[model samples]
Every structure is written in C-alpha cells, then in structure tokens.
Target: MDQKQVRQRIEEIIDNNAIGILSTVENNKPYARYMTFLNKDKTMYTPTSRETYKVEEIDKNSNVHVLLGYQGEGFGDEYVEVTGTASIRDDKELIEDLWTDELDNWFDGKDDPKLIFLEIKPEYVRLMNGRGEPPHSLDL
Candidate 1:
C-alpha cells in the first residue's frame, strides 16, 4: 500500500486499539513499556511522569517505537509497529484536557508536577495482518 493508505490504516488500527507498547532506548539498551495512547491531528499522546525512566531516556534520545495490536485467534487480525521521535509536553492545559479518571491507574489519582504527556510523531510504520508475512511499510 501507499503512504497515505498506510497512514490511514495505522490511524484506524490505533483508534481501534488504544493500548500499545512504547519502546525507548536507555543506555543503548531497549526499554519497553505498555501505554494507553490517544491520537489527534497526526500526533500520538501518552501520559507519563518526567521523573520516569522513559522520560529520561527520551530526553537523551527522542527515538521511540510503538507496537499496537490485539491478541486473538482468527484471521483478518491486524497489528502495527510504529517508529518515531517523541516530544515531552508539560502544558497543564493539554494534560488536564487529556487526563481522565481512567488515567488514575497510571498516576494513583495524584497529578504530580512531574507528570506530563509524551507526543509522538511517527516517521515510519510497518503494518502486518494475521497471515504473519512480510509487512508493508510506509515512510512518513
């Protein structure tokens, strides 16, 4: 598929599955964490704390990877792997707007000063289906 189609598919997949694995590099080693994400205007959002290791790793290296999919038994299943650079935003307005009671699970009901949002703009993505064959990739 073309870049536009790939982007559209990725957006659809992300919209369908709000949870993903966000991977970052720390000390040249891969660090992966599960995150609940929001997508808007081509940007992906996830709440995180500034004091967290993921934040520190992103500060040193903005590169990040995201894996999104559902584990189920059947055909026509979908999955995506997105690679991008992340930016940390501590804007209270944005954070407040994105924050929901559901987010309490991540922050324990305390909106700590160190808590912020991670904005990811994907540079490339690879999409796969249940067939488990070579994935079609798009360069953004």
Candidate 2:
C-alpha cells in the first residue's frame, strides 16, 4: 500500500478500537497497561491519573508503544503497532473536548485535578496482519 492508504488504514484501526494496550519503558524493561484510547485526526490520547506509575514512567522515558485495532479475542487479526513519544498533558481544554460520561466512571468528573491525558505523538506506525502480509510503515 502507498503511504496514504497505509495512513488511512491506521486511522481506521484506531477509530474502530476504543481501548488499546500501551507500553512504557522503565529502566529498559517494559511496563504495559490497557488504556482508554482517544484520537484527534491521527494523534492518540489516553487518560490517566496524575498519581500513577505510568505517568512517572512517561516522565522518565517518553518513548512508548501502543497496540491498537486488535481486541484481544482472536488470532491472526489486524492491528496497528505505534511507536511514539508520550507526555503527561494537563490540558483542561483538551480534556473537556474528549470528555465523555463513560470516562466519568474513572475520574471524579472532568474537573478532577487528578485527571490528565497522555499525549502520544507517533513517530512511526506499522500496520500488521491487515490487507497484506507485508508490514507497511505509515508516516505521521
């Protein structure tokens, strides 16, 4: 696939998958957790509490990986492997934009001080197990 096609495929994957496993590194080891992933265009965001290990890990090492598109149910399914840099963003305006009542299940409301978003800016995105056997790299 060409770059545009690959980019579209990735956008579709992220749009179809609501939750994804995000991996962050700590002391060269990987720590991963399921997160409520959100998107704006091609960029992805995941909400997290301030007093969390993931936030600390992001602080230490910004590089992270996100596995999207696969729902953890079947084998040989399609997914997107995203390699990116992450930062803990305390942007209330962005929070208000992505806020949903479903997320209220986690925080004390959108205004909660503990609420924050992990901003992931993808540097390299790989399309896996979709369309063709060849892995396609999509530019960010």
Candidate 3:
C-alpha cells in the first residue's frame, strides 16, 4: 500500500479502536498498558495520571510504541504498530479540549491536579499482520 492508503487505513483503525496498548521504556525494558486514546489532525493523545509509572518511564525515555486496531482472536488480525516519541503534559487548555465525561470515571473532573495527557508524535507507523501481502510502512 502507498503512504496515502496506509494513512487512511491507520485513521480507520484508530477510529474503530480508540483503545490501544501504549508501551513505555522502563529500566531499559518495555512496560505496556491498555489506554484510551484520541487523535486530532495526526497527533495521538492519551490521558494519564501524573502519578503513574509510565510518566516516569516517558520522562526517562521518550521513545514509545502503541499497538492499535486489534480486537478479535488470533492470526492476521489487523492492527497498526506505531513508533513515536512521547511527552507528558499538564496543559489545562489541552486537558479541557480533550476531556470527556467518560474520563471522569478515572479523574476527578478536568481540573484534577493529577490529570495529564501523554502526547505521542509518530515517527514511523506500519500496518501490520493484516489481510495483506506484507506489512505496509506509513509516514505521518
């Protein structure tokens, strides 16, 4: 697939599965967890608590990975493998902009001091293990 086709597929997958596994480097090892994510333009956003271990991990190593679009069982399941740089932010404007009532289940509303967002800026992405001939590389 070409870059444009891959981009559209990536967006489609992201729209289908808002949840993905976010991997962070911790002590030179990978620690991953399911996270609810959002996208605007081409940037990926995930809300997290400042107190979480991933915050420290991201601080130590900005490089991160996210696996999205996998839902059903087993082989050839469609997904996007995202490799990016991550940064933790406490911007109130951004928090408000990305906030949703569903998130209140974890946070004490938008102004909660612990409320923060992890911004993942993708460097490379791939449409992996799908119904295709080979993995398709994508750039954003």
Check candidate 2 and list the clashing pairs: none
Per-candidate clashes come to: 0, 0, 0
Candidate 2: Cα lDDT at 17: 91
Question: Runs in model 1 with CA error above 4 Å?
Answer: 2-4, 72-76, 108-111, 130-133
**Model 2: per-residue lDDT, tens digit, 1-140?**
79988888888889989889999999999999998899886678998899999999999999999998886556557899999999888887999988889888889999999999999999998999864468889865
Which candidate, 2 or 3, would have the higher TM-score against the true structure?
3
Highest-scoring model, TM-score: 3
Q: Relative to the true structure, how large is the alpha-carbon lDDT of every model?
A: 0.84, 0.88, 0.90
lDDT of 1: 0.84
Report the lDDT tens digits of candidate 3 across residue range 68-118. Answer: 998776687889999999998899899989999999899999999999999
- Pairs that collide in candidate 1 are none
Clashes of 1: 0
**Which residue pairs come into collision in candidate 3?**
none
Candidate 1 per-residue lDDT over residues 1-140, each given as its tens digit: 67787778877888999888999998889999999899888789998878888988999999999998856756667788889999999887888778888877667554577778999999887888836556778776
Strongest candidate by lDDT: 3
